[model samples]
Target: MGGAVSAVAISSILIANRGEIACRIIRTARGLGLRTIAVYSEADRGAPHAVMADEAVMIGPAPVGESYLRSDRIIEAAQATRADAIHPGYGFLSENEAFAEAVDNAGLVFIGPPAKAIYLMGNKAEAKRRMLAAGVPCVPGYEGDDQDDLAFAEAAQDIGYPVMVKAAAGGGGRGMRLVDEAGELADALGLARSEAASAFGSDELILEKAVLRPRHVEIQVFADKHGNFIHLGERDCSVQRRHQKVIEEAPCPVMTEDLRAAMGSAAVDAAKAVDYRGAGTVEFLLDAAGDFYFLEMNTRLQVEHPVTEMITGLDLVAMQIAVAQGEELPLRQDDLKLNGHAIEARLYAEDPSRDYLPATGRIDLWRPAAGEGVRVDAGVATGMEVSPYYDPMLAKVIAWGETRDVARTRLVRALKESALLGPTTNSSFLVDILQRDAFIHGEATTAFLDEFYTGGFVADEPGGADVALAAALLLDDDRDAAFAAAGYVSATQLGWSSAPLSPIPLHLTTDRGVFDIGAECLGAVWSVTVGDDLFAVALGQRTDHAVRARINGRTIDAVAAISGSDIGLSVSGKCFRFHRARPGMEDDAAGSSGRVVAPMPGLVVDILVKKGQKVARGDALAVLEAMKMQHQIAAPIDGVVTGIDASKGDQLASGDLMIDIGDAAE
Candidate 1:
């Protein structure tokens, strides 16, 4: 670590990152009476960071390669703004040793560890070797420097099946695959290596034994230039999807006082070996036997640091600033105490049922849940696009309670009330995983994602009720209501409506069906029946295109919008009605024909077909760029394109029809 003598007074600190991290750092800096400078790429000019900081600098164009990753431009921004220090708030150039050195050479304090410490722990293979030498327990697998496929496969087999093939430079869960069988190892290796190479610019990987039934528990480590270090307890990150963590909680479900001390000591040892300073995370894999193994150290602050803060009641960013100012860590291991448990769920613009593909769109209606144990750390607000230039994560929703179960349940409740409309999100997926029996019973593991979630839906999910309700009632409440009026004993209004009408036949919603059991207007109150169920109903004032009804013994708010003679209930939340209609209720719009809809809001990457080309159902039609990734838009069914409304390089938002696939075969 740097041995520079410094004082706490700093005019302003420049954040070298963008999005949520930039906003987060600025908020903390403001809290401590420090002025903040935010640098932005063209893509993030309208982002939260642009407004959060006291001063903003336009670094470069949209691509991170030209802006955020360009360390010289960042340092120059700091110099221009008279920023006394720079905080690399994780990702991008956060862990770049040369960036830190450049900041120091330019006479500005770098709010992280020394460049030498970063270099020492930045390499995965080298980090493991150093940890092993420092008496830290590591997974029993080959950490050899071999790139040959045959040699790597042999090492993987030696480690046995169920080993993990990891890219040495991989983070954020990309370029990593789990191999449960020997026959699958070769394919996994090739894919993992290719992805890793593409992502991190280094395909060189190191094989490691995948600890069976292990929980991901990482310790928050902090150090100062004076050799003072302490662990801020552990965070459980076992709730994951495709090896990417979705939910993380503090004071792990299985962590005990004895185990915490041991793991904390090991993390401290790992940091001391490299003279690590500032905020860093020492990750570990805790097996069912209660033993822990060193699982790489993140040289920068982590995404789930909020959960640790909830338990420890410490501002980690503030601590990083103080440490950067040559101040020793204010607390020792004895002073640390973790109270109330906290849990954090990552809100991504991704569809859960679909391979967790990230989504992009304008957050038309964005409202974060408030009150009672809830905290939202978000980057984008309404109208912000989840662009393809950066991470797909929208926010980190955290809930703190007296117990872990309370936190889990509270988060679930918050998610239930939270409404998001414009774009598809993973909110419903979090609800599904949290409501599962396995999660409630504390059966979390790295394999939990694939185990409970099959490629299909469960026989009876609560989401079905909403979909069914959308199908049965919200679709055609008027004509059907006149028919199904209960206790009528007459066909006065039900006999006809403008034209001679027959009683609408009953159709099932889920297993529940609607029937034309007649209707009677008793004074102001009306009665209707669905099967043998009788309900007293009343009509509220109708808005244009929607009818509201009060039904049964409970008040049911249904938006019945008539699409021709049928109905289209705009059921809000993640469940926007089923992809297919229930049997006979199939309408024209329900069928995927003649329209190429915008999947989400994003920039158009490529448009593959001409206006009159023939296409298949799965043909790559257009590429939509969102949330830092490109998603291919495929044709719905075999058809000729009637219209091409969009072209490559066009800026688009959700629901804008770009292509039309229509009229080939009915």
Candidate 2:
């Protein structure tokens, strides 16, 4: 039970984060009758969170290292805005002990776990030691001070192969690797260390036996100064990509009542281990034998906290704020209970088929799903630019239902009905997972995505006629009165022109590959054909980036937005980007275009080749860092480098020429 302890009065709170999480915290703070202050960089001047807050302050540039991660700037913003408390809404400095201390020293309440708790639990190795002492099961591995490469390799051999090399100081999926063989240990170690040092300012690593097909289940724990602690059930975040969770559901389907109680008790002990206050999470790897090992403790709110809230009918943020004010948790362990099933799908601006590389562009259309049991939390709006400076997650689509099946179905429907254009997303991939039998049967594990769907998730391509129709609508004068008028004409009478018009030939490239479409407009009707398929379309009035049309006697609703030289089309929540390729401009299979271009906006972190250097196909030519991840831009073919246009630290836009690689001599 919590006790009445000294508490600081708070009226206004400053959120030291951006995007959806900032908007989430502000909503809760407003509900609690508190003014919310938001901080943003130049890139987020018009972001939803900044505009939604009671007041906003510009901190620094777009780069997070110079902006959101700058604790001093965040504190200054809070003080200048006359805020009483600061909520570091996950990521950035949310789990940084120094940031917590800074907030406390600035005479403001840190709406999270205490600074000492964060410090003690932040280091994965030390936290494992603490968990072991507290009788919490830990994965078999080494967390010793001797992090010598040789010693680590030996420890991996001792713990056995397929051990996970992880940065002790970092969260998310960063600074982590799974070494399946002895041969892979060295590379995994070096890369993990480098990523750790870069991300968390510490290269210290810990190795653990990679639990095969384990379930990633975390308990939401809340504590108060009065010494009260409670676990709000468990969330199975087993569906992941690149070590980051993509889907999370509360009241894990596989969890029995006894298992839930056992895990909940362990989580409570974990919170008590650090004397944690406010909200935190105790993550564990649940094995097939029903045994669970402590993975790590997140000393802040989690990105998937909404699912927990949906199932428990609790506002975790509000509870966090109250606990920060020294108020005891209203519910005890016995009083807390789970209700309806809840699931959350994280929509990210990344291509699932391309190793999850991030995408950046303006959101031409953003219409979240709407209906009962559906809740969409997003910080983006139509025309908002999705930059390379932050996480690629655009929003969280959460659904709740009376049963797990009901919830799963609702979530799948919501994902299919939600619309986003411009940047590619994993919406379709999420729907695929929800529909998979492995997931529906509640049998998915940490290896579910890789093991079951090895080919990667791909959305179904629209019909050839549909594709041709979309292209024709985009190229046609959408505002033409004749087009709107023809939409109302009888289908039988449509396309009956006394004088036939010349067919408009268009070259198009889409996710489904390239096609040559021909269109002949007859008043409001258009004859669209792609290859052998022909489609008669009645074009309706256009609205902003969307259009209403009837194709082959069937009405179709779609969004058509112009993005650069490409056209983006969205129908039934699936989006496709098509480049209008000129007939003579298409590159041959040999990539004779003779140019190596940046695939997306990013910072050139490394130039692997110099001018005049010879390279082969698939050779790493350079490394570009974007969305806090590194991507290798490889050579398209065997060629000799003729020019280098970018250097380390150079910011590049999508299509910016990186280097010129002329064809190699025979």
Candidate 3:
């Protein structure tokens, strides 16, 4: 190890990001007795991260190009607050070489690797070249600088079919396309270029052979300015959807001691090749035969770093700060030991049934899970609005235990207990993945979702018991309100009539269908009937947002959020939404309107069809960009385009009409 250099004193740090990552960095900085400053876009003015910071500065508007990505504004915020350092936490300018250099030029400590290292590793094409020179095994593909379409086509033919078109300057599944044959190469290249330019401000492309069904394992490597480097085991991120990681666990189940040593040493060599500093992750594609090839190096801390921290008992953010202050690493490779297994699942505000389309709305209820060995890193709260301007990830739930099975069980229970209402979420889907036989046996590959859920995930409809519970809860709430209005001393006097009370009737609507439910209050218990099924529900502990009740002698805990006529409830790790059907409110011709509407809030990237153009069912109509992903809107029926209400570059809200289709004869 090299001798210690002059230490850079840092008293305050301005976090140059938002959401859970910003909150995560602020917490560590605060624990280390450092003042934290947060910069936010107008859309995130009162977000959790902004509220948690000692001081907040409004950087710019909601669009990242106008706000978080503006390095000058972030530096200005830090200087204005008299902060000594800037922590670009995980996204936005975190891996931007120019931003890192700008911070250094401004005399502020950048709590990450040097600008030179970022430049060398930020681009996938160049990073592959460097890794190859350093004797690191790499996937066989093309990373040449020829920007011609013909060049890429020829390269694809040379590399064989089923290749990946990747953005040279970024990751996170954006600007990446999988091509199955030569016929799909052109469109893949065009779409990948468009996304790459939009997301990373670069249209440079790289081609890699699609390593089929490989496990995505990455090594968490840390280095200090004193030249000491060590890697904290590996994380298996094979469970994915749309090329993005959904679940991550430490100590990849398939890893052997020899394989670990080889991969870890390769990761350290890659870090040393770039003179890397602070936190970084070297990703690899490990095949079934135990051969691992270098994928790329993320020059900044990864989003799934928490699992490694849990198993290794280390605080990576603290290590980054210490390295930024010119401190030597506290431990060596031999000193590190993995104590247990840990798994983390990302909680996103999205609808899996709708092709994972991002959802936007107010978070009416937010209750993260709490238990021994469970950790929740969340950046949302009740009443906060989830805007379309940023990522849909709301939080990360992690659990650690003495074994992988214990960790998996704890994580499943925690997800089931957590409650998030208003916008649809993938919490239920996450629970399903954790309980899968393949996952439980640690035999999952990157193609797990493709092989199992080829038709996409469709959530199960609410059962009779669930519907009855919702109806009963509504009835009880109404009774309590009425009793208070009548100046009753206590709500317990609601059903104390000397004679038997009549049953109350309600019609509740869900996506499955409408149900006519009858509920009667019989002393302390409710007799709820849905169709022919009857349930005896006895109320227990109750709160404004949650209730514990025994249904048919089986105790169940549930949380609910009431907004007007809609009720959002969570039970058994699944979410059910019910709407109290009002007379004269049902539309007779809702689905046959022949109108195409935006499924979620997004910006129109392209309008493929124009007025008077005939279209067949499933014909491409338009392309929408929402939450950094592209969604293709297709024609619902065979008809002529009668009218167009949205244009390219238009920002649309959910359910906004985008096109009109009339009968082919018309």
Candidate 4:
């Protein structure tokens, strides 16, 4: 080690990030008896991490460019706080070599790899060349430093169709595009370059042969300045959406003992080539032929590091801090062992049904799953606002078990039971993914989401009785009395209706469409019927925000949040939003008048159509940039564009009118 020959010490650490990862690093730092400092943007002032830290500092505005990405400000914060070290939690400037060098220059420890190592591995082209020199097999593609677009096009042709155009300076599916055919190469190149410049400040591109339907496997490698290195097996991140990993699991289900050893050795070699230290991941593409190709090296902690930690019983953050303190490797390669299977699902504040567009709103009800083998690392709490200024990921739900099936089962159950209201989330879709036969059978590929879940996985809709129960809960005058009266009563005296009173008619609208139902008390019970299905409900107990109710002789748990005429409810692991119908609400005037609005709050990136343009339903009208991703706003109906109210570069709020369309005939 570089410092004392025996042991070094760190008194305080400033975490240069926000959200769950920041909280994660703080917890480990606290456990090690080190004072933790937290840095936040204006939007994250009230975030959970800020509250958990011993000292908190405001960096700048909500945008990352003004805050988290400001390395000089972060280092200044560390210096002002008298922090001995800085821990960059995965994102922001975690992989920036300049930031590491700045911290070092400021006499502060950078709790990650050396600046030289980061610089060597941060450039995708240079990293691939180093990996190849180290005898690691890389994906077949061109990583030349040529700036010519025609050169890239020619390189793609040689690499074959279905190539991945990626920004050489960054990862996380940003500035990355998958070109499937020769004709789509130009547009893909243009968009990828634009996004790369915007996100990573780099327009350099690299072409890789897209490993068709391959599983994304990555090895967690830890090294020390003492020249000691060890691999913590591998994680399978095959389940993805929009080229980003959605779910990750350790001890990849299909990995045999021999294969694991081979990949682990290669990962160690890759790490050693750059003289890496701290926590890093070497990603690979495992093909169906049982062969693997190096993808890239992440020179900092990974988003999926929790899965590796769970399976190996190690705190990666603690390890990173220790390595920074000039401590030797805590455990040798032979001393470590993988004990169990672990799976982690990322909980995002986004609506999967709407092309996974990011969502922003207050979290009214936050009930996370709690039980054996289930762990939730969440960033937001009840009444917290999920802003659109940052990434939409709110938490990571990790489950551990002795077997892959057991881990999968626990993760599914945990996801179903966890309830997050107000902003839309992907909790339900994660459960559906866990239940997929391909995933359960350990055959899922990187193309799994595109192949089977392209239309978005729809969770089971609530039954009529569930809706009735929800409405009753939302409209209930006495929660205590309703729970107190926990038995079946005669319909005539159920109190919902009496004498000449008629049953209430309700029109419930949700993302799945509208549901119309009539609810009333029958002769012997409070019954609800939809189409041909009938149900009887009895309220049992109200605990916290959840209600244990018996519906048709089966007991189930549910939670609800009421806001004016809308009710957001969770039943049997499914999330639903029901808006009570108002008089004449079915025929909305603005919608009928052909006024199409922006579906969310975002920056208008591109306007695809102009005034007087004819378009069909589902035709692209404009593109909006939100939550660091782009979403296409499409036409809701086939009509002529009579007016374009919004222009490029305009910042829009949700439901802001964007276009007006007038048609000839319906």
Candidate 5:
């Protein structure tokens, strides 16, 4: 396909993906004067990527298996759109060898590596074998065909304690588990196999020695069908949670020139060994001693590709299109140079305080940060619903600077400046990580979160000042509504009273608890009291999406979204959601009420308890699968199961009752 005769002129391209990556690809394709087609599920009909594309096609339902993962539907959509090529952005079908081959059979260019390369690297076991044959350093492990439990037990014993059981076809941490001892091997294997089958359609298992505290560094390599390959540099993706990267940065802080050259050479060799084309990442586990071992090769652009693009000053997507068009290398290795440092933070719609449980709700407000060296790759907007049918990642915040410190500071500030409310997010948690000394000094390793946040991250309680601000905002909204209802009456006469009006007592409920607040509106200013403290707030320059307010002589610009009685406010890089409490309308204590509820909307995969069964506190009661991950619902208290409201294969919404537990005595 490299020769001139095989060159396929491409004028239109279809993106078989969704969210920010799809939008990102469209931007580059549009810049290159190519018509862009987007395919979406029913849940994404109004999504940003679908709206931004030159043309859009509805593929199927919301479930990935019925939509994004349907190779036939994707190819049909491409043919219907008459697109010259299809770009499978990361995740779904990006690394699927069969999908790539299917695209080729359809006579449409697949804007990625050849199907053979994808097949060779898609399976961890096969990839390790090939890398070993290529003389690449790999971790000591077992990749034999024997899938028996006894075989895994023996392999773990030989590999010593703390072995990693991984899915052969897994990415994004699915179907992976760490076994610290032989005792936990079976359970780990079972869970891993289930997740692997659900996520990648493969339950093939492999064993590897757990590289304790190694930094996850990967080289970004690009190649053309003409056999030219070069490495851009390395990205340090050491800070992670649940084995998924949370933060990534270019020019690994601990990297040396010699080490970069060594790793780069190895990565290029890995690419050449497979005759890989377009963009790929060769991940490695770098020890403190600077020794690195081959991890695996990702055959598509990574979620963190923005970090590389920021430092390289080149569009990797554009390069991928060029390679798909049978173009030669744009530049040689010697001409390539890494410019400033860049860092990326993924913004996910999840609750860090709740073990990072994926959240689904309407996005009440979305105001991405904008400034020098800051870029936001997002696919969400105000009033949009974050569906539970896809990944929880909502956006990516990346910053570039001349130095690592500069980039770190800018990213922290940018994360704070940007606002996303309604659904719980990890924004504040990300800020805390940026401020951690371990991360700032560049000493973070794979165990960074495990060592630092042993009990998981618990956000600080909203302070009195924030509560006062919420009360003031709610009062201001009420005043504005009153004015608008009065047929555009003058603001000065709207709230004017002949006598002193008693402060309106309100109760605002937050995750911390219910707060009793009193707000008194006096002309343009407000006197809000939370507990014993009082705040004089004067709001200035209010808009639909933001407001400038002075609280006790300190002026602050905050993004605000008010919907009915619910209020979302962001100020000084902190976000707070407040629900106006009414009489006898407080939330029920679910645990004390003996109600076992689903934490989020998902399908019930398994029910571990039966009616009349006695269970202790913290016992696993059921498992709910959502967004490609399994979350166990645990018994909140010791009780007898009086009723089972949900059955296996049932789709449940957030807070839907799954089981009813009665007192143990019953």
Candidate 6:
């Protein structure tokens, strides 16, 4: 470890990020009686982070570049608030060396590793060099600072047929490409370089050997200025989509005591090489033969830290603060004990099967499960709008139990009890991941999603007739045309009316199929009959932001959410997310925006065209990335790029811009 600092604690702490992570840190700081301040963009004026902090400061507009990325404003806010420490939550300026340096020069505690450590690890190539020097196993490839595509591709070919071209400036699967052959090397390297250039403002790249069907395993390491450091075991983050980790669990199923000891010692050595401090993670790709290679080290708390906390019964955030306050590590390497198993599932505001497109809308029902061994770290609430200006991650649902199976069961049960009503989400898909035979058998890998997910997504997807029955029963209100004791039809309007009664039409949409049917409600129970099928449902108490409805005679569980004029129901083994019928027929399937649509709420980072510009398919037309990640919106086909919309920085929503096309054949 590095030399000890004089002291680390300060009077107050300024959180340098927003959303659920901000809220999560606030809770920890408040529990420790440490004053906390929150910073937000315009779109997050009423966001969860602002409401949870002791002090809230308005930064800039919704665009991250204008708000979160502006390190000058953040430092100003910290000084203005008299905050002596700055806690950069994961994302934004967390790994930014310059930001850390500015904070240190301002005579404030950075509450993380030293600026030099951040600088060294902030660059992938340099970190790999440090790791190799520390005798930590690294991928058998090149980490030299090389920007030449041909040179890097040649090196990649030397590493063998399958290799990964990655951004040397950052990690999280961004700026990463998997090349299978020499012919595919150029395109992969170029794309990786461009994405890296846009996201991290650095096009520098490194080449590495791709572990065939490797499992992503990372070790949680912590160090203090007192020259004490230890490892908190490992987490398996193998389940991923588009290179983004989705499901993470502690005490990997394939983990062995010998392997853990070997990797743990190596991780400790790596941290020591950087003289690291505070909470950080050393990630690795573990192959089938028990061999592992250093992937990258996250110099900040990971999104899956709660899983580590659950298994160890340790408040990692509190520990981080204590260490930053100059406290020495209390436990030795041998004293660190691993107990139960824990798992975390990321709840995102997106449609999983619809290319995992980010979504935006008002959260009508925000229900998260809270029980023993189940914890929810969430940012938004009921009535909150999921803005396009931020990450689609709404919350993280973590569960703990004595055994892995128990933990998985608890997580699935907790998720089933949650009801988040907004735009289409990935709740059902998360459940599917948990219940998959391979996932259950501990056979998960980075390509697990690629093997499972097919295409497209429908909201409230209840795929079978059983789901339809459950939905119908939940909405039943016992309607009849015959006269009742009040001398009028029971299904008629509340006020006296002489007009002839007509059948009431109700629509139900889910991931399964859309249903246009009739319904009736009777006290706590509802009955609905579609065609020859009769259904009955008993409503349960409101749990979270959803209404649990039990279908009579069906063992399948169901949930229904009422948002505005729309009702989304998940029943049987399927789901249906649909809107209330309007004047025109609905298109169940829409085009994939072959031209270009804003993937998330973001600003046009750059515009590279004007009207009548000829462009081919896959050409970089415009760039629109939200939540700090850069997305290159490319052209879909050969056509004239007609009608340029905005300038360098214009905020946009999905489908907000349309590039006109005359030749449909193109």
TM-score of each: 0.77, 0.93, 0.96, 0.92, 0.97, 0.86
> Candidates' lDDT values, in order?
0.75, 0.87, 0.91, 0.84, 0.91, 0.78
**C-alpha lDDT (0 to 100) for residue 557 of candidate 6:** 53
Worst 10 residues of 3 by lDDT: 490-499
**What is the per-residue lDDT of model 4 for residues 373-440, given as tens digits with 9 covering 90 to 100?**
99999888888889877889999999999999999999998998899888889988898889989889
lDDT of 1 by residue, 355-417 (tens): 566665455555667879998888877667666567777888889999979999998877765
Q: Across residues 1-666, which tens digit of lDDT does each residue of candidate 2 receive?
A: 444588667899999999999999999899889999999999999999999999999999999988999999999999999999999999899989999999999999999988899988999988999999898888888999998999998998899988999999978998899999999889788778866776788999999999999999999999888878889999999999879999999989899999999998999898898888989999999999899999999999999999999989999999999888877898998898789899999999998877787988888888888999999999999989999999899999999999999999999889987888888998888988898999999998999999977887655676775586677665564323344586654322343444445778878887546778888877667788888888888877677766778888888888787765677787776778888888745534324466888888998978989988999888988988888777888888788999999999899999899989887773
Candidate 2 matches the true fold with a TM-score of: 0.93
| lDDT of residue 168 for candidate 2 | 95
Candidate 4 off by > 4 Å: 1-8, 478-505, 517-535, 587-594, 664-666
Superior candidate under lDDT, 4 versus 5? 5
Q: How displaced is residue 665 in candidate 6, in Å?
A: 7.1
Those runs of model 1 whose alpha carbons end farther than 4 Å from true positions after fitting are 1-4, 456-553, 556-666
Candidate 2 Cα misplacement greater than 4 A, ranges:
1-4, 459-462, 478-502, 511-513, 541-546, 562-566, 581-583, 587-594, 608-616, 638-645, 659-666
Candidate 2 whole-model C-alpha lDDT, 0 to 1: 0.87
Q: Candidate 1 lDDT (Cα, whole model)?
A: 0.75
Q: Which is the winner by TM-score between candidate 4 and candidate 5?
A: 5
Residues 1-666, candidate 3, lDDT per residue (tens digit)?
687499998889999999999999999999999999999999998999999999999999999999999999999999999999999988789999999999999999999999999999999999999999999999988999897889999999999989999999999998899999999999899889988888899999999999999999999999998889999999999999888999999989999999999999999999999999999999999999999999999999899999999998899999999999999988999999998899999999998876898988888899999999999999998999999989899999999999999999999999998999888899999998998899999999999988878888877678888887888778777777766788764344443433334797888987557788888988767899999999988766578688888899999889988877888888887888888997334543333567999988899999999899999988989999989888889888889999999999999999999999999898
Ranking by TM-score: 5, 3, 2, 4, 6, 1
Which segments of candidate 6 are over 4 A away from where they belong?
Answer: 1-5, 454-460, 463-501, 506-514, 518-563, 570-576, 583-588, 592-624, 627-651, 660-666
